[model samples]
Every structure is written in C-alpha cells, then in structure tokens.
Target: MNALLIGAVLISFSSVMVVLAGLPPEVTGFYRLTGGGMAMLLVLARAGKLKLFTPNTIKWGCVAAVFFAGDFVFWHRSIAFVGPGLSTMLGNFQVIPLAVVSALFFKERMPARMYAAILLALGGLYLMVGVSWSGFSADYRLGVSYGLVTACFYALYMLSLKYALSKDRVDALVLASAAALVSGLILGGLALAEGQSFVIPTLKSLAAISALAFICHAVGWFLVTRGIQTVRGALVGLLLLLQPTLSFLWDILFFGKPVNPVELSGVGLALIGIYIGSYTKRKKRTQ
Candidate 1:
C-alpha cells in the first residue's frame, strides 16, 4: 500500500519531468519547486504548525535551497545533454548514498540480505544506459557528470530534511516553503547572470512545472516523510526506485524512447533490487 502510493507519486513526477525537459533550466528550477512549497506553507500556516524560523532552521533551510537549486539546474542541463531516461537513472542513484548514511548516522538498518539490493539497483541503472560506454561524447560526458552531481545534491537535500523532520525544528511545510523561496531567488539571480529571461514562462512550461512542484516535490516529500516514519530505512530507500522506473516509461510514451535489450535488462535489475531490498528487509523485520 505504501509502496503503491510512492509508485504513484513517482509516475506523476516522471510525467512532469518529461514536460519540464523543454523549459529553460532556471525557470524550470523555480516553478518545479516553488508552487508546491507555497502550497505546503499555506497548510502549515493555517494549522499553526509553522514554527518560527530559527538560526539553525535558516542554516539548514538555506543549504536545502542551494542543493535543491543545484540539483535542478544540473539535472535540466543533463537532459539537454543526455536523454531524459539516462539522466533520470543516474540522478536516481542518490538512493545508494541515502541508504548508507541513514544506516551509519540515523541508525536505519537492515539485514545482511539487503546488500544484494544495492548491486541490483546499480546494475539496473548501468543497463538502463545500455552499459555500452561507447558514445561518451562531450555532451554525453558532461551530462553524466552533471547527473552524478544532481544525485549528490539530492542526497544532501534528503539528509538535511531528514534531520529537520526528526528534530521537529520547524514545520516541514514551512521549511519546504522557505527553501523554495530561497532557491528561487538564487536561481533567479543565476538566470539573470546568464542573460536568460525570467519574466514570463510559457503556458505549457508553467503547467509542466506546476505539476512538477505540486505532485513531485510537495506530495512526494509529504508522503515520503510520513511513510518513512512507518517503514524501514532500507525499505524507504528502495521504494523510491519507482521514480526512475516510471520516468523511463514516460520517456518511451512521451519522447519516443525505445528500450533495447540492454536497457530492458538494466531496468529489470533495478526493479529486482528494489524488491530484494524492500521485501527482504520486511521479512527480516517480521522474523
């Protein structure tokens, strides 16, 4: 049930990202996050769950801003370089680091059997790219680099948010809202420095980014936080594997992406990993 909900959220973002692929990176960055942040903020404010912004809240929130900003900028750039499917797969690798850090620092643990899941997930990502490594052209190379960077930044965002959520430092909704505003301002500056237009984004692009924010950032994070409180750390990590899976499906239907044998096998491996990680952990917990 929890897994299904996460998968549904993943599918929503997958479709949204396909739409966002056509927008300017900076514009895409702001719209993809800010609306959802505002929505969450509104709920928090009305509920009086909105905590006062503290120095520490500002610190972590600002860091989240930078990471969120960096993640989108580089991810959008990666899509421009590599195709969406490959970029999404690589960016999704942040799950590996998240699982590891949660185990080390947050005491999120699973049984020995869970190790196999990581390998399967990585294998899936490798296969998703066809594992050819042949066409490492300047664009592809740069895209890969940026994709990995996006993963790193995303991992940081996850960790920071996890800390904030655990501490109840501020309302999650408030934190999200402030982070988006900060990130929007930062990206707005970068767009200015790059001579990109910031005034009016296209209607199509606005719609795409609106879906990205409301569905992806706001809903995804909201449910993930709630789900994580109930599920195991490894299970939570594995559940997110849905994002890349559904994102690839969107690439095929929307962008005319065709899966080769290698790619299919790779995606299979990723799904297997998720099953191994999540199911095995669940069984261990039961035992």
Candidate 2:
C-alpha cells in the first residue's frame, strides 16, 4: 500500500517532467525508456536477478513494449495538444475500455453502481473536453483524439502486463527493464527517422530527463509493479487515480493552465465516478 501510494505520487510527476524538459514527444519517450531501462538493468545485475528472464517473460515483455510504444507516441502527442492535466486524465480513461473488456471476456459482473460510475466518468469528460471539442482549435481536437487512442493502448498494455506478472513468474524488474529497453529502441528509431536529435542541449532539460528516467520510470514503476501484485484490482484503480488527479493539480500549479468552473466540476464528477465504479464491497467469509 505504501508502495502504491509512493509510486503513484512519483509517477504523477511524469507530466511535469515532460513539460519541463520541453522536448519533442518521441525524444522524451526515448530518453525516458533507455535511461530507465539501463538503470533497472544495473539494479537487476547488482541484485543478481538478471537471470530471471524466461521465455515467457521475454514474450510478454515484448508484448508490453509494443503497447507501451503506441501509448507513448499518442500520449506525448496529446500532451502537446492539450495540457498535462487533461491529457493525463484522458489517458486514465483506460478504465472504461478495460471494464468493457472485463465484462466481455472475463465475464465479470457489471452492476448498476458500476454503470452509473461509467456514466459519471463520461459526463465528467464531456464537461472537461467534449463540450468544447468541436469549437476548439484543430490541434486541441487532435490532442483529444490522441488521448483517447492512448487510453486504448494503455488498456492493452495493462492487460499484457498483468498477465505477464501473473503467469510468467518473471521478476517485475526484469520485465520492466526489458520492456523499457525494447520500447526505447523502437522509439529511438522513430525519433531518428523523424529527424529528432538525441542531444540534451541544456542542463535543465538533462536534469528533468534524468529525473524522469530514474525517479519516475525506474523507481516509480518498480514500486507500482510490486504494489499491483498485492493490491486488489478495484483498490488498485482507486489508488492509481492519484496519478492523474495530482497531475491535474500540478498542471494548474506549474503550467498555469486555465480552468473554469465547468471544467473543475467535470473533474470532480469524473473522479467521483471513477472511484464509485472501481469500488467493490468485500464479500463476507462463509463459515
């Protein structure tokens, strides 16, 4: 639980780091992945856990990498389009798709409370982004679209990761490190193809990127993966919500993104809805 709390808070700084770095989307993703991957690799080597990568681990790690790649590309683009808060919130919308998948494939029961929660989340989104979506500039709309796309890929990544963790017996560090390295390679190629430089020109940008890699990616993900293994699914969702919620607040505090009453209300509704949707009553033990 402490791991989840700390990890969520740490990762919530991701958008702020990206904003501070002020680099191209792919560039930021590249450095984040590669640098964090290397850091994790070193940690694994030091701990002598580098031998834990099995065939199953590699396969699932590759799968996670692909989905993460898509997520990073679209999510960073969305961040460029909209501010961090809204973009992060939009990405966290993965819960909607994930729930639908659960119902369809896993045969999970969706009660009325869950349904209401979904509607609330959607209503909140409508207030935040949908209401003015058409009236907004082309870039903004495009950002919103990318954000939704991000949610899809993020759902896929979560599914793959959860499966990998449950079935593969792979250490979380091994999976995370390998996936980050692979995704970094993919993004690195894309960055080069798009003519983006790998150079960090300013020390400030370097510091931000370093913090992003070591703090947010390496430490944050390690703690999160550990916590997710122990925490219940619904509770995990509620705890992880801290990431976007704090991220939105950070955007307001740091980025000076303008927020109106309608938008604030929307955020509240969406957050409440998400919590309600994810809440599950514990069943009493049978004698």
* Top-TM-score structure, candidate number: 2
**CA RMSD per model (angstroms):** 4.1, 2.7
Worst ten-residue run, lDDT, model 1? 278-287
Per-residue lDDT for 1-287 in model 2, tens only? Answer: 88998999999999899988989889999999999999999988899988787777888889999999999999999998898888898898887887887788878788888788889999999999877777899999999999989998988887778778777667777988888988998898899999998889899999999999999999998899889777787788789889999999999999899999999999989998878866666555589
List model 1 lDDT by residue over 13-132, tens digit each.
644464564667887676656676777777677877666666777777897888888887888888777767767777777767667777888898756656777888878777765376
Full-model lDDT for every candidate: 0.71, 0.88
Winning candidate number (lDDT): 2
In candidate 2, position 156 carries an lDDT of 84
**Candidate 2: TM-score?**
0.90
Clashes of 1: 0
Clashing pairs in 2: none
Report the Cα lDDT for candidate 1: 0.71
